[model samples]
Target: MDCEEARFGLYALLDDELEVSKNLEILSHLEGCPTCHRELELDMRVKSLVQAQLAAPAPSPELWNRIVRRIDQEAEVARRPSGGVAKWWPTAAALRMVWGAPAIVLVLSFSLWILHAGQVPSPFVEELVQEHRGSVTRKRGPVDLPATDPAEIVRHFRAEVPPSSPVPLLAQEGARLVGGSLCHVGEAKGLRFTYEVGLGRIVSLFQMPRPTRALPFWPRLGPRYIAQSQGPGVLVWGDARFLYGLVGELPQEDLQRLASRMKGI
Candidate 1:
């Protein structure tokens, strides 16, 4: 096997999940390959340390009896016939875990990748698109409250960008931060920071490097503009010559008000 494939397999081998034949094949490869031999040695040392630490745990005899009983009970359940159907009913705790929303979401996120499996972008294109989505927490998901006062909002946002980066200074007079996310913009990652102002409306913030925007960028389309979705307004502008698209629910007058607040034009 190739070194890269073998390196990935080494962890599974250490875990003893691969077949004996596959392990022998990997060992043969590792024998001839000095690089792989080094990797295997490292993995062996780490595994031995972990196993030694794990082996230190000693269960009490009473707890061991309970574990044995539980295992036997599970085995009996597996053997029993449930109304002539194959036996496999979950215990009560398992049912609760199965129905939990967070668990459902975790499973769905993994499945969602398969559902959206499309043409994988080339490395060049992959390098261009930005991933701006942030982690979703259990309680509030990803959105966060925006600072109402312009000075505080400026202080907050400035901290996000690096000192050497070309992000514009804060000029959002009346807008409040609603929530924000990082999103992909063509080939580059952009920050999708959203703001809400008067009348329960939203103004989105898009931040991206100006040059790497999609195929049809500036001069042909626009330097900066606003778009709407589901009644919410989005303001797209460029900073340090980068593109930023702000999207949220709101009116036209307020939306432009949100847009013009930045000096980037």
Candidate 2:
């Protein structure tokens, strides 16, 4: 099976809804393809994590009855003739006024449900994933500012970016600073540092000013925070000044270790 087909059936396979023949084909493909196997593993892990974190409470019967009654009342109102103050208002406008509150509630509840289920990723997570994917998958020779010294990269960033921005030097046994580039996270100016880890593994550290809006969900890993964005693992934390996010195709434990090291600096 091709990667696309395997991915298409991944959800069904995980839920044990696939036919035996199709399941065997996907299994065979996964055994031969490390990328597909890793993707499947990550999906399962994320699913478990979400299930553990979120508790879905059943709606109270009273609340359900109230909602049904409200819907019936609105329908009755719509069927009635225009009268009194509502006579001047258009039918569509009247309907909107009656349904706006429930509509908003439903929208927000759906958004939160999807987010908690790990079905729809946040915008910040999406941005980080795109940036990391571009850096890793690009058919390029080297990064923009190729340098081993973190100090030199900081100096370059200070010259190009905001001088007041804090650029912490990140060092670990299996990782070394390669280069960096100026970037942005939302409207905030930021910097992305690339590191070369063991066996050509590339990791990216993105930093920006602490965003005004807090993330809906980011699990704490010691003093830092860790999240999985699609396939890559992301570790994020902040000091008084800046917010930092590390993205790579590393295990959660490995990413947590890296985040701990970065947090110390």
Candidate 3:
């Protein structure tokens, strides 16, 4: 399979939505072509970020049906005429009086508010969970910059990231740095460090410059903030200059301990 073919199937592959044969074909292509493999990882990261931001409790189907029923009832009431002079009718004058400019303005304002409320932004740490699930658990090869040595990874990131960013060195026993990759936590650019923490588990560490705008639902910088379990455990904490996160299938306590041992937090 070529890169274009692989790109078309990347999301399906990540979601396990494709047939087994087609999945194998794309995996084979990815294994052979580093560029396409990296493309797959990028797709994974982007999908993660989007799912995090867009995730919200959708209005139930029953709720929508109820809304439709209520609207129909209101329309029926508006169309009906009263038995006496005091009764209501859908007269042109009455319609104009009911839906005057002020009423129209109120309806428009309410619609806008609903639109804004439905788009509530999610925390960046959720994105980290998805990033780890996709880039580490789902697929493991073809990092942007591959290096086992901490210093070498540091050198690569120094050139790729800003000067203020200091990459952490993993010091936990049995955990070894696999490589590094460029990733996006929402719209902000970030770096991901891949690590193998033994027993078939992987940990992904993400670091990026602090966002200028406050992210909704993110904890203040100080102690580690542990997010609710979402497939993998996520731990997030930030300093004045940068934000950091760790994602793994390991227990939350283990992940937190791993984060604490890192040279830089």
TM-score versus the correct structure, for each prediction: 0.35, 0.43, 0.46
lDDT by residue (tens digit), candidate 2, 129-190: 34654563254313366565888888877876568777765667857676676665545666
Distance from true position, residue 265, model 2, in Å?
Answer: 5.4
Q: What is the lDDT of candidate 1?
A: 0.57
Whichever of 1 and 2 has more lDDT, that candidate is 2
Clashing pairs in 2: none
Task: Show where candidate 2 strays beyond 4 Å.
Answer: 1-143, 218-223, 263-265
Model 1 Cα lDDT, one tens digit per residue, 30-132: 8989998998889899888887865354665457655665787787677677665444466543555466658669778987875455234234321211221
Kindly provide the TM-score of model 2 when superposed on the true structure, using C-alpha atoms.
0.43
Give the poorly placed runs of model 1, Cα more than 4 Å off: 1-162, 168-172, 178-187, 211-222, 228-231
TM-score winner among the candidates? 3
- Quote the lDDT for 95 in model 1: 53
Instruction: Please give the lDDT score for candidate 2.
Output: 0.71
